[model samples]
Target: MQVKTDFNEKQIQILLIAEKLFAENGFEGTSIRTIAKEADINIAMVSYYFGSKEKLLEALIVYRTSDLKIQMENLSVENLDPIEKIDKLIELYINRIRCNKGIYRILHFEFSSEEMEEKMKILNDVRDRNLKSIETIIHEGQAKGIFRKDVNIPLISPTIMGTFFHFSMNKAYFKKLLKLDTDEAFENYIQTTFKTHIQQTIKALLIYES
Candidate 1:
């Protein structure tokens, strides 16, 4: 599905509010009225902007994921080595999810609902495109003899995403375990320590061991 790229400030505000509601309440549980009320607008304005809850969900997904697609496209054209490309990809994915935790949370919650089959298709399509981009980078590495020939391309994305998702979902527990008292400190750990660990994990999976 083609996503609308241009949005006004009011439209973006509505989308952000909807994303937060959807993450906390799930798509089926969130109503247009609720979103409108949260955004301090009338239901008619919500209807005018998105027409319906389903379309709003689609717009939210598109708004959240389109930039990542663009970033991946840009990364594909860079002159970096395959290993460097993978590292950059890891950084991009982590940073994107960190910044947009609400939308990602919505995705995780609504992805398996039987009522959201159509919306899940949109999400799956975006995921497939990203996985294909990662696969391309791995193929480049293998072709250059920089990575192992026996790599399982399909598992790579899940490995990176799943690890982060597990950590993020249980962050409160981990925060106390690690003695991270402030949000800034936890974010610092993610960008530095957690990010480096993921990069190294992917490197170990892809790189050739002589």
Candidate 2:
């Protein structure tokens, strides 16, 4: 069966080019005409498909976040022990940044905008559901006696995210700190550290390693 998607070739190209431009330049720096030219499409087509320049930016943000949500959704810890689950979380975190470097750049660079405050409010409306998913996984691990019941998930969830957050959020600083350029080397550091830290975190939590 053939499935229909929201965008056809041209619209997707518009979005792809817009995202790159938006990431390179701030919202104020990018313009609809510029995006149309970059996409090699008619300026009227950009408006026809996306409504307005602001709507196009909103669409780009949605596209980025929805992609992250899909990746998070695809993750499974159903049969894995808590120790393994933690390791999986680490792997997912590092792998996500690796795969979505451009989106990560957008999140890192644009999240501070005043316009994004309202958009973040909308995304925050789903915060409970997202946090609960993490809490449930943590509690399940505890119930199985593979994780510390005393562990504070409220603390841990943010902590795990912080690990990835710092690596991504402070990427420019780290590029200089580590004397590295490009996302690939940054990813290598993450992969190396995740292996070390995940092993240690799980060992400390579970007490016995198998």
Candidate 3:
């Protein structure tokens, strides 16, 4: 006898199709019928499982956000230096976007959606949590005279994040601009350019403090 899996496959199928549809079409553009058609399920099953379209979208966002939170948690920052922490954050952000192309694409595409006003509120909370972690590391480094105390925590946090964002945001353009299609070339770009920018920024901010 075969043992049954925990999550219902039918529910999983609904979620998978819904995620892709919402990603491709903004939340307002997606509909229950479209999701049902995409999932090859009865239209009524959509309402039965998710209650409403809004709830379905919320579920999809929560699922993706959970994955991101898990990835953020996996980086061991307790014993690392400020610069290393920044590097780890960078690596994590890049890898997260690279690995989950669908989610990142959806996020970028929906960056300015009207629905995002509410979503941004949730993101701000997550960003605040992540920023606090980074802020603590910066403070520790400042105490050790390794990082400049004058550096703006808010500015620094977003600046460090901007590198990964820019890379992923303009991935297609950069890929063509550099004419480097291979993975080795991309790794070199991340290491040489991306890493250099981060290290140099830190050094510039910290090295001159008395």
Predicted structure with the largest lDDT when compared to the true one: 1
Candidate 2 worst ten-residue window by lDDT: 121-130
| Residue lDDT tens for model 1, 1-210 | 566778999999999999988888888798998999999999999999887888888888888898899899889768999999999999999999899999988876667766576645677788888988988888889889999999988888889878999988888998999999988988999999999999999999998776
TM-score of each: 0.92, 0.70, 0.71
What lDDT does each candidate get?
A: 0.88, 0.66, 0.67
lDDT by residue (1-210, candidate 3, tens digit) is 211123366877787787788778866698899999888888899888767776565555555566566555554355777667666766666566556666556555665766665745544555666667667767767888787768777776556556666875676788889886976787678766776777677557655445
Model 3: residues >4 Å from true position, as ranges?
1-9, 74-77, 111-115, 119-121, 156-172, 182-210
- Candidates in order: C-alpha RMSD to true structure: 1.7, 4.9, 5.6
**Predicted structure with the largest TM-score when compared to the true one:** 1
Clashes by residue pair, model 2: none
**How many clashes in each candidate?**
0, 0, 0
Winner of 2 and 3 under TM-score? 3
Greater-lDDT candidate between 2 and 3: 3
Instruction: Tell how far residue 143 is off in model 3, in angstroms.
Output: 3.0
Better of 1 and 2 by TM-score: 1
